[model samples]
Target: MESLNKNQLALLTCVIALSFSETAQASATALSPSSPGTPYSQLSNKVMAISNERIDKQLNQEINKVNDVMATRVLAKIGDFSSY
Candidate 1:
């Protein structure tokens, strides 16, 4: 009976070890960053691309506004060139 108990204990210990190893592996994979080909990475790239495009558009608008102001000032300084 003692030998049988010993065998059962050993088997239980092995099962527990295997389960812990599997759990650790699963958690490690979950915590790791997603590969570039993954959907999550693709989505992030798309979001960044959109954000950059928006920034470019806003910069262009501001540049245009400044140009318009400068042009108006230059025209005012020229005074009635039409008479010349």
Candidate 2:
């Protein structure tokens, strides 16, 4: 396989993702709706199912948890290094 540059890869990925999402949405009324069962649609559907407020709340909580952990580790390291 040929190597693709970062920008080309990113653009290609986005294009493919968009295609699958559009196809899945179009196949919503199909008898099988198999594409919707794929990870792409499952994630899209999950996101669509929830409200924007809930998404923001979850994102904020995740960010807070990450920041808290990082702060705790940094403080611990600084204290340990300073006492040596």
Candidate 3:
């Protein structure tokens, strides 16, 4: 095998060091108490709450739309100039 040039050697050393550092960090994180499940549960609850609020908002919007349509139809039927 050909000997590596100085720059290539330096680059290879940096890559290996970074790989080991990443592995060590991953191991450290895995050993911590914060697992994925707890955060997922919290996130799921938040999503559900947001979804419910959006649904309620949509229902209110539909109700208002219907009310406006009915009001316009009533106004069209009563076409006199001054009865207020």
Candidate 4:
């Protein structure tokens, strides 16, 4: 098999490291709810519910980013095979 050049190897390493870091960060963030001491703390229960809803929305966005990356990778493999 042909070896990767330095630039190609570096780019691959960087992409892998970034993916790992993003997965780790999302996992960590998913473990905790938004802190009560922030502006959400000062609001009534109804407003606090809205704030929590927003937090959930943001969490879903992060999760979607991870999913999108995985989907892109799968599609790339499919494209590679179909090109033959």
Over 4 Å off, model 1: 1-38, 80-84
lDDT of each residue in 2-81, candidate 3, tens digit only: 43255445655555555555545554555456665657566556555555555455556655765687688779768654
For residues 1-84, could you state the per-residue lDDT of candidate 1 as single tens digits?
A: 587467656755655565555555554554467644567665556555554555555556655765687689779768767558
**C-alpha RMSD by candidate, in order:** 30.5, 11.5, 24.9, 11.8
Q: Hey, what RMSD does candidate 2 come out at?
A: 11.5
Q: Where does candidate 1 clash, by residue pair? A: none
Sorted on TM-score, highest at the top, how do the candidates line up?
1, 3, 2, 4
TM-score of each model, paired residue for residue: 0.47, 0.41, 0.43, 0.39
Each candidate's lDDT (Cα)?
0.59, 0.57, 0.57, 0.57
Q: In model 2, what lDDT does residue 68 have? A: 82
Higher-lDDT candidate of 1 and 4: 1
lDDT of 2 by residue, 1-84 (tens): 133255445655555565556545544534245544556666556545543444455546655765687699899999999998
Error of 2 at 37 (Å): 31
- Clash statistics: count for each candidate: 0, 0, 0, 0
Error of 1 at 39 (Å): 2.5
Worst 10 residues of 2 by lDDT: 1-10
**How does residue 39 of candidate 1 score in lDDT?**
76
